[model samples]
Target: MITVKVPLQEAERAKQELMRQGYFLSGYSVQKEGDHLYFPVKERFDSPYAFEERALEARPEQPQGLRETLKGKLPADVLGRLKTAYDQVGDIAILEIDDKFKGYDATIGKALLDTNPKLRTVLAKATGHEGAYRTQHMRLLAGEDKRVAVHKENGVSLIVDVEAVYFSARLSTERKRIMERVQPGERVLVMFSGCGPYTCTLAKNTEAEEVVGVEINPRGHELAEENSKLNELTNVKNYKGDVREIVPELGEFDRILMPLPRSAETFLDVALGASHQGTIIHFYSFLHEDDYAQADTWIQGVCDRAGRRFELLGSVKCGQQAPRVFRWCTDVKIL
Candidate 1:
């Protein structure tokens, strides 16, 4: 029953240091007691710089999900080729298995279930997102046969069909960032709001008077409506169909959210139609590191041509899309 104890504030730094030195246990979450923090370790080791180790009640190490367990079980060559990244929704784990590893899908799925007792199903992604719905196919590798999953984000629950609509758990941070900026009684519009994550998060977390979300995918729209009720958000209004068609009818909004990074630019004209003199717009895009200014420039050009001036509020790298490419968000105010 040995553990590494540190002041609560230094716990994170200590755990990170232990992890860097390959002495930290991956399964147990950091535990806090009064002003002290405890981190589980495999065995006693020399304490780095400012850390101390002491014997404490031994908590059984819980096996973390697939990735960590596979490292010691699988051959180095096979393990190196496998994708360690996956998405978990409710009790399901969604994965993108490479073609070469197709034969081992069942084995991997079982391992995932074994390591993570909470997960009841594992679905292998069969294709990339396509069409207006932005959905892909999934094959059940193990456990339950259902594709429907209820995911929670930023205090709101969203029900989604993995094969019928597109959603990303990776965007949770971005959703929270945008939601935190909304002011009381402000009217907000979320374009391409798959499963209503952004819309519901705003409605539930902020005092916005109304949050309207437009989706092209019927399935996603239906789930969005369900999510609104699930979260008991009376301010959310979901519309089915293309944003281009829906934006024209919704009048002007105090803030507009364009989450479709790759194609958000193409819909700027329609988005502008739903804006007033001081509408705040959150525009998302994917750009290489060197082309960081491209999204802002494009928005400026469009605004200038339409006789509307815009103030660049700020820009940030939301997430990494690939090696050098990143998902960027540019916040601007139309004036």
Candidate 2:
């Protein structure tokens, strides 16, 4: 598919024309590239740069009753099962369910599409998760992609134009990917595990003997349990309570995922003293790339206070945050 970048006015005009005709808008992205604004569209595979080029060759005229293609029908039984939690936006269908889900799967996404015999090639399941369905009507995410399952990330997923939200760092996908570096067969202590993303991912993806996930929030605790079941991860446990009181009592661990980005550095003492030789303490922060050396100095200072040394394991780009603010995680091995 051709990814074309155009101006906003052009994009709106193109979008209207595409809908007025019979063409489907596959991908839509309006982004800021340095000083220029761009609207990117994914072109039809067999078409020219303009969708009209393809329309010219195949149908001479814009086909009749194009909106009929969108109001595609699904089975009554399916709609009955989905309840009234679904809202249709043009060709896209969205389902909103209040869930602290156990794990992610396709069976959970039975509402993204309906078997529609109305179009030549049904364009269902195109609009995945969006940001509008957040709990308490708090606008957190743009929306959940309907086609992409968070657990099915072993495969391809949709792309989203993410925005900054208050306390949204706790929900970042970087928190999930960096946890992949954790070695197997290690007892992990994940403080502030949120919804157990790191805990369950570690358990299900590794051969860990035990993973103790701790969260203080009651709703988070319930969501963690649900996430544990969703991923079907074994050898993992979720403890619902503040970790400051609970962590010291849990004894020692070979690894720790200190994920509370704002104060992850403050927990360094607990991580160092609680760790044995070769233990890795994964820490995330809002520091700039140049500040990594400063972060290392600070971490090593904690190591020195604890009568130990640490080996810096470097950092990587998690995702983009706001203007000039990016989130990154650095690993250090305890000596």
The model with the greatest lDDT is 1
| Model 2, residue 138: C-alpha shift (Å) | 1.3
Candidate 1 residues lying further than 4 Å off, grouped into runs, are 1-29, 33-65, 71-73
Q: What TM-score quantifies how close candidate 2 is to the native fold?
A: 0.54
The 10 consecutive residues of candidate 1 with the worst lDDT sum are 46-55
Clashes of each: 0, 15
Candidate 2 per-residue C-alpha lDDT over 1-335 given as tens digits, one digit per residue, 9 for 90 to 100: 23334344234333333443335433333344443334233345322123222211122332222223223343444434432222222233333433422122233333223222121111122233233221122121123443212222221121211111112322324544655566667899988776566776677767778999887766566767876777666788999876777888888898888776566788788777678888888787777655656567768889888788878887755533455556667787887
Candidate 1's TM-score? 0.84
In order, what is each prediction's RMSD in angstroms?
A: 6.1, 14.2
**Model 1 clash pairs?**
none
Candidate lDDT values, in order: 0.82, 0.52
